[model samples]
Structures are given as structure tokens and as C-alpha cells.
Target: MDQVTKIANRLADVGGVVAVCLGGSRARGTHTPDSDFDLGLYYRPPLDTSALRVLAAELTGGAVEVTEPGGWGAWVDGGGWLTVDGARIDWIYRDLDRVYRIWQQCKAGLFEVGTQAGHPLGVYSHSYAGEVAMGRILADPTNELAALQEQIQASYPQPLRDSLVAHARWEVPFTLSLARKGVTRGDAFYIAGCLFRVAGLLAHALHAQAGCWVLNEKGAVQAAGQLPTAPANFSARAHALFGALGATPDELATAINDADQLAADVLDNLSPG
Candidate 1:
């Protein structure tokens, strides 16, 4: 068996593991040669982290620490990172019950964002649903994950889309307002941070407007640029705006204005007739 298949089988055999899935770029078919593998281990409560640690050690030929549930954070939960046969692999834990609950909440147009390491914009509650929607089931003996995936794939909830778009669009101006203050104080870093947040929010709005499930902020703006509802030259304009930032107050002000204009264009495109 291939290394991935072997790994998936071993993971499935671990106690409490309900399913194994291939997520991220690989599952989305957008991966390049160097893209790492993202394997999701969906489990019930009371997972066997010790067994997972043992498997990681055996595969990597070294000690690896696997976090207990919520070790990473509330939204991220916990998992491990490993290198097998020189290929990078990420094991992400997903609680089966939580995943389903989040999906139901999203269908009702309810979700929240929570702080999580490695996610500068925070983790979206609906992302749990997005991961399942975008992931491919590699091992689901009982078809548990498969059933959820089927339901998620059947349709992108209109309420969820409307909620995401409305919330993100509303944040754009609020975030820019903060950037405006930073610009007045000539705080380049603070201004830049606000601009990045605005960009992230705009990406969210664009993706939702297009009825796309964006998993995370990584490459999200460029990805949204490809969506049918995205404003013309969206990605290029965003990149240029970032590249144009300068240290001077005048320059910072110009950048903020440009960002606001870019945001306006996006919101305009999303506007109803």
C-alpha cells in the first residue's frame, strides 16, 4: 500500500477514530508538487491521543507530541505534525459531534469567529462545515463522515451564504475605521494590520457572495478573485495596495484611502439591483 493509504489505515484503527479524510489543497486538487498532506482524523469524545503519539513516533522514527483535545485551541482542537518518507503531513482533529452541530448552526445563519494560533483573522465556526464540504473521505468504514459530506455537498446553505457576506461586509468599514486612526498616528504596522484584516474580510464577503466555502484565509483573496461575483482585477488591486504602503503618514493615508476604495468596489459588486 502507498504511504498515505497505510497511514490512513493505521489512523482508522486507532480507538475512537470515526473517519479519515484528505483535506486542504490535496483534496481540493489545487496542490503543487511540494504541497503537504492534510489528513483529518474525525473522532468522537475521549480520543486516544497516546496511540496517536505512538503512531507518529513509529512513522517519523522519533518522539512526537500529539495534543489532547483542545490542546491546540477551542476552534482548532488538537493534532500532530509529522514528516514521513520526507513528505510533510498534518493530522487535524475534528470532533464528529461538534462538526455536525456547527453545520446545523451555519444552516441557520449562525456562526462565530474565535481566536486560534496560526489564524491571524481567527477561526470561523462555519469552517468546520467548509472542511467537510471540501474534504474527500479516505476511510469511512461506517460511512459516518461520508453521510455528513453528502449532506454538506448537496447544497451550500443560502442562509449561511447571506450571513457570511453580511457580517464580512460590515466588518470591512469598521476595520478600515481603525486603520484610519492608525494612519493619523503614523503607525505603519498598525495600519498594515488593519488593512490585512480588511482584505481578509473582503475575501470572505466575495467568497460568500459567490456561494463558495472558503476554508481559511491562506490564499483566500486570490481564490476569491476567481469567483464569479468578484470585482474586476480584485486580486491584483489588493496586492498592489499592499505593496504600495509606505512609512510616511501621507503615504499611509493614501494606502488607507486606496484600501477603502477597493473595499467599496467589492461591496458595490455585491450590491443587489
Candidate 2:
């Protein structure tokens, strides 16, 4: 069986695990084979502090770190956090009641979870909420995306609308998927960079639509939507990265392929079934 299935089975075997859900890029159908399995395991009541620590050690080979769940409210670096077969496996612990509520919201296409990664990390609504809502609006393909595209285009000055669509198509899916699974990979820094660009673009549109100011890479203030703020010094960094991305598209493709291969290798070794 696949590594994903293996993780799922292992999680199920654990006492108190109430439900297991596979999320992230794979579940979203946008994963490029290199993506890792983001397995979220909901346990009855909730794992105690000691249990959380033990699980983390077991998963990370004594290197699995633990971070207390603060504002976002989901325990991170808890047990079940490990790197297996070059793919990161994050075992997020959520109370069964909360998990059921999240599942209900997910099914209703709410796309908002209370806290991700078993921490107080709530879902960034502005990020994926628009995408999910837009997906529904454009479900008919009756010029729905186009209509929104036009509205955004006319409302925004230049490049912002096009950029948002581009990101909404490519970048946002990856971000939302990662956020969904509570697993993130920084092997390619560009993932974060791409998201930075998306935020800038969204801010631009939101500013035009709602009339607000957004901080940009250069700190040159611009009218952007009330979207999330861009990274402080991202603009200067993006130039080189874009050039690198263009030059190494194949390398990026290979990297993703390598991740998938690694996940496969681990799965082969573990043999879920």
C-alpha cells in the first residue's frame, strides 16, 4: 500500500484515535507526485500532555519537537510528527468534537477549521474562503470565473487582477492544501515566495474594491484590498527567485518527482497492508 495508507492505518491503530482524514495537496487533486501525506488524526477527548510528548519522540526518532498550542490552538510538533521516506508526516491532534465540527464545515464547503495542526491556528478565511466560494460560483462555467475576472480587472489598476487569477489557479491551491493538512515543505522556498506575491495581488484588489492601503515588498504603500499583508522584504527577494524558477522549471518538476519517489520508498519499506 502507499505511504499515505500506511500512516492512516498506524493512526487508526492508536488507542483513542477517533477519526483519520487525509488532506493536503493529494486530497485536493492538485498534488504533483512529490507532495507528502498530511494525515490528521482526531482522538477521543484529546491526548494528554505526556502522551503528546511520547508520540512526538516516537515519530521524530527522539528528534520530534513539540510546540505548545497557543492562539491557533492545535498542538504542533506533538507526537506523530516525523520525516519518513523524505516526506513529512504531521500527526495533528484535535479533539473528537472539534474534528467532527471541522468535518462538517469541510463538507459544507466552509473551508474554515478552528485551529490547524492541533494548535490555535485558525484557518485563514480570506485565503481559501474566496477560492472555495469562487469554485462554487464558477461551478457552472457559465462565464462565472470570467465575470469575476472582469470585475476584478476593471476594479483594479493593472497586473493585480491577472496576478490574483494566476495565483488563485496555481499558488493558492498549494497553500490551502498545505494549510488543510497542517504539513508544509520549505524545500522550495518559492512556495512561500509565490504566496507572498498572491497576498500582494489580493491586497491590491481588495484595496481597490474596499479602499484600503497595503504594504508591499518595497514598503512602497499601495492601495490594496484588505487581504493579508505581504512579507516585509519579499519584493527584492522575488526577482531572483522568479528568474531561478524560469530557469529550473524542470528541476522543480524533478524535485516533486523525487518527493513522490521517496514517499513510495517509505511505503514500500513499511508495507501498510
Candidate 3:
């Protein structure tokens, strides 16, 4: 860990970079051997990407796919995919300006689900609060993460919980309705997509009940499965939801009915199931 911290600190030493931190399952100590190294470099606005670009070009040996700030998406900002010493390393760019705004929004009882591509979970950006609050700090010359974590965890604000629960309550049923319609239309693909949305919303509700914050859909189920409201035999439910049976549309009608029941259960509960 010390060695990794030194590497992260060196990366933070890059011009315009304020700090570098570890993220994802590795940071949480839940990583598999195949997990990619998730590193995020936080920077203030008007950041110069030139140094980062050159470093990336050198690190990945001219196979760099770095993007400018906000090029990937608003909340995620930007970063790069690089291979160093034959290991998969994900270099993420975090705009401190945006992070601060999102953090403030969280404090002020504001949050929204990201409908942008790759975020099918519709997670609230303020959930980045988790990344900042719970994530391990690697480098903080100016103590940026310490202050950020303090502010983020200042309280387990009820409003944030209320907001997530409310969103999940509505979204789950709504998406399930779409899934039912897809079943009637014999649209297996549409039904499958809706199931993903259903699970995502259920995960949101579960997290909210536990007063937990979520950043992405990655490992959402594993995070939520331990909660009380997690469905019975969650692995089987998830497998069925994702079509482990490869159910045809006619077969999906039963799945859709089961899905509706799942949504109803989640909605009726004071806490997630």
C-alpha cells in the first residue's frame, strides 16, 4: 500500500493536478485479481491537460485514450485508459470545481440521477460523496481529501436518504411497467433492458435505506445484497432477471409478473428488501 501511495503521490506531482486518490473495489479492499487499477487525479478548473497527455502517451506507449475535462461526461469529467507494465490501469480526471458543486448540492439536499450513457443505474451524482467520503486517500499535500471527507460526512443527512428512496420508489415501478409492455410486444431486448433498470432502482432504494451512497452501477448488487430488503435468493433473482434462462418473450411474461411483484414489495416496505 505504501508503494502504491508513492506511485499515486508521484502522479499527483504532475502540473495542474491537485491530488491523486485510489477508487473502486481496490480502494475498498474488495477487488479481484482481474480488477483494473482505478486512480483518479482531482484538479481545479482551467487545468492544463498537456502534462497529463504527455505522461499518458509515455505510460501507455502511444496508445493513449485520454479525454479533456467533461469530455467523457459531466459528473465523471474525464481521464484515460492506460496500460503500465502490462497491468490495466484506469486514470480518471475529476474536476474539483464540479466535485465541489456536487458536494454542495448534496449538503443542500440536491441530487439527480445520471441519465448519461454507461450509467444505467441513474445514480445521483452527489453519490460521489461516497467516493470522496469513503475512498482511501493516497496523496493530499494540501489536505484536500481530509476537508472534503469531513464536509461529506458532516452528517448522514436525512434529505439525501429521502431523495434516493423517493426516486427509487417511483423509478422501479415505472421501469417495470415498461418491461411489462415489452413482454406484451414480444420484445425480449426491451424487457431485458427494463430489468436492468428495475434492479438498479432496487439497489438505489436499498442503499438509501442503509444510509449508503452509491457512485455507479458497478458492483451495485454486491453492495446492496446484504441489505434487509434485498430480494430472496438475490443471486437467483438477478440471474433470472438477466435471462440466465434465455427466456423467450412468452416465457418473459412470467418474469414480468415476478418483476412487478418485486417492485410492489419494494414500494410497500418502509425499508428496502
Q: Write the per-residue lDDT of candidate 1 for residues 164-199, one digit (tens) a residue.
A: 778767788898888888776789999989988888
Q: How many residue-pair clashes does candidate 3 contain?
A: 3
Q: Write the per-residue lDDT of candidate 2 for residues 24-57, one digit (tens) a residue.
A: 5555465676666656554564445455556556
RMSD of each: 1.6, 18.5, 2.7
TM-scores for the candidates: 0.95, 0.36, 0.87
Worst 10 residues of 2 by lDDT: 132-141
Q: Any idea what lDDT model 3 has?
A: 0.74
- Note the clash tally of each candidate: 0, 18, 3
Give a tens-digit lDDT track for model 3, residues 1-273: 554576677778787788887888888888888788888888886667777778778766785867888788876778888777677778788777678888777666678776666776655787677788767778888998778878777766677777777777777778877777776567888888888778777777777777777778887877777778676665456656665525567688887777777667666774432
* Candidate 2 Cα deviation (angstroms), residue 192: 17
Better of 2 and 3 by TM-score: 3
Best-first order by TM-score: 1, 3, 2
